[model samples]
Target: MQQNLNYVYPQVFWVDGCTSASASSPSAPPVTPFPPPVPDRRTKPGHNRERRSVGFLVIFMLILLALTGVGLSMFQIFHLEKELAELREVRSAWPEQSMEKEARKAAHLTGNPTQRDLPLEWEPISGHAFTDGIQYHEQGLVVNETGLYFVYSNVLFRGSICSSQMLTHIVYKKNPTLPGSHVLMEDKGINYCTGQKTWARKSYLGALFKLRKMDSLHVNVSKIALVNFEESKTFFGLFKL
Candidate 1:
């Protein structure tokens, strides 16, 4: 074959058999020249198709990223709205809860002896005796709310003649849940007096208990006749914890 001396510039050939060159002669084949010669991508149909596929893939990835970002933003907005709704609910209920707590704090009463029944009755309003949320019923103090409470009682005993019998003072709760009163606290006096002479004794009992609404508390002694019905010496009282 005859040599085609039309080739003027240095020819560049890639591994794929594509060529690249630049010529000063106008008759030279049109070729774009660049350093570090690579495949002549413009001349090959398969190369052109590959470049188009890569461009489309890049565009698809960009669209997918944008959609993902929008979805995340929407999710964050929904979460914030839910938290705000919960905070509003709590804020709306706060005042009522505070009022109830104040009411519970005021549920306290003290009573002095008024009657000599088996379950001693009391005068809740006379002398130092006072009643708030608690009420004095038939023969006991009635609970108006359910909570822990401090129950307390004091009793004084005096007689002209000393007796060998035991002295007992008890504070108990009467509830519908049980058939009988449940003793919450008790005190017993033994050998309190030695001679057959006039003497006086005092018994006090106090404790913490879990009380329920509608429950009643009463004081009991072994002998009602021996009790001194003084307001300062004999009284029952309770306050919420």
Candidate 2:
């Protein structure tokens, strides 16, 4: 009674106690839920705060280093300024020291021995022709300051007839403590001239002597008449070191 339809058609089947096919699809074989996607741990609020704190700490250290460097530079500048001040003070006093040295004590006397006594008298040259210290007195050069001095004297003896007599020349220093003048230098000429015709001789005494304050210095000769009065030929002088 039936002719074959020969037409194929899709089929639908329903399980027992299911309302819809999708809901009843065997519950997707008990799926495992993927562990809630791990919540993106690097983006947590506490971790972000820790990173910010580290950045702030690094910035603070850099600031501290910069301040320390500034302090050191300031200290060096102060030290250099102090040294400069000291150098300036020393320079300011240099000229005064040089001037004190230049204003030293000294004197010069010219001419022959005028007196033959122990403290011989001298003939001083005209003003500006000879120099004398403020301590110099008549007939002698007085020392006002205690120091070393260079003393010198020269004498010329001349005779028409050579007597060959002994000529004595001496420089003496006198002070209040000494009873008599002390001989600073001495020279003796014995049998000096050989011929009788217009004989001449010279005696010179020069040396360094340590002198005290208030001391007096003078030149002496055995015979004052034998001395030459010329300024260039006969002279006595002293200068402080």
Candidate 3:
């Protein structure tokens, strides 16, 4: 005895959607379709270039701001250093000046024509003449405090006739350490006037000097009679610095 067997295969159907129908039946099942894939807007070349440009601009601005901040900080540091240096200088000088405030050496003397001698004499106590922490004796200014001093002198010369002579004026100082007087300043006039005629001339001397205690300063002229004794015209002065 023999037996007979049969096999059946399923069929597929294509439509607008993914639905299937069987060969043995007319009805089919419906399937939901997936939405269309969205276009990739970020993939375009123009949009990529625009994004890159914005990023570069932001980075450049940030770098510029950082550089400006650093420059301002350096300038402030330099300014502070300069101010500190000036303050240090002032503080260093304060002690010396404060100690000598009460006994500061200063003197101003007017000319005295009555005392006609080799080295010209001065009136220490008359008319606009004064001495403080200094001494005037023997036709000279005596230094009592040792330090820097600003020494100044003015002399006026007048004559009824011109002698065409060389006129010399000198300021000198004498101290115990030196054998002779050391000349500090000098002025000379040669052939200033010719023939017999009324003429006048003036010589002025002023400078800073390191003076020592007990140093005596004197003014000498080639001709003492030629010097004018008017208080304002001829004068000598000095002040401690």
Query: Which candidate ranks first by lDDT, i.e. highest?
Result: 3
Model 2: per-residue Cα lDDT over 1-241, one tens digit each? 9999895443334445332324345433443333334565557898889999999999999999999999999999999999999999999999998887776778777773455554445555653235545355757888888888999988887778878578999999899876988999999999887876787789999999999988989888887777776776777778888
Which runs of model 2 end up more than 4 angstroms from their true locations? 1-94, 112-119, 125-129, 132-134
Give candidate 3's whole-model lDDT. Answer: 0.88
Candidate 1: residue 57 lDDT (0-100) = 100
Score candidate 3 by TM-score against the native. 0.58
Each candidate structure's TM-score, on Cα atoms with residue i matched to residue i, is 0.56, 0.57, 0.58
The local lDDT score (0 to 100) that residue 228 gets in candidate 2 is 76
lDDT, residue 235, candidate 2: 77
Rank list by lDDT: 3, 1, 2
Which residue pairs clash in candidate 2? none
Give candidate 3 misplaced runs (Cα > 4 Å): 1-99
Q: List the residue pairs that clash in candidate 1.
A: none
TM-score of 1: 0.56
- In order, candidate lDDTs are 0.81, 0.77, 0.88
Alpha-carbon RMSD to native, per candidate: 14.3, 11.5, 10.3
10 residues in a row with least lDDT, candidate 2? 27-36
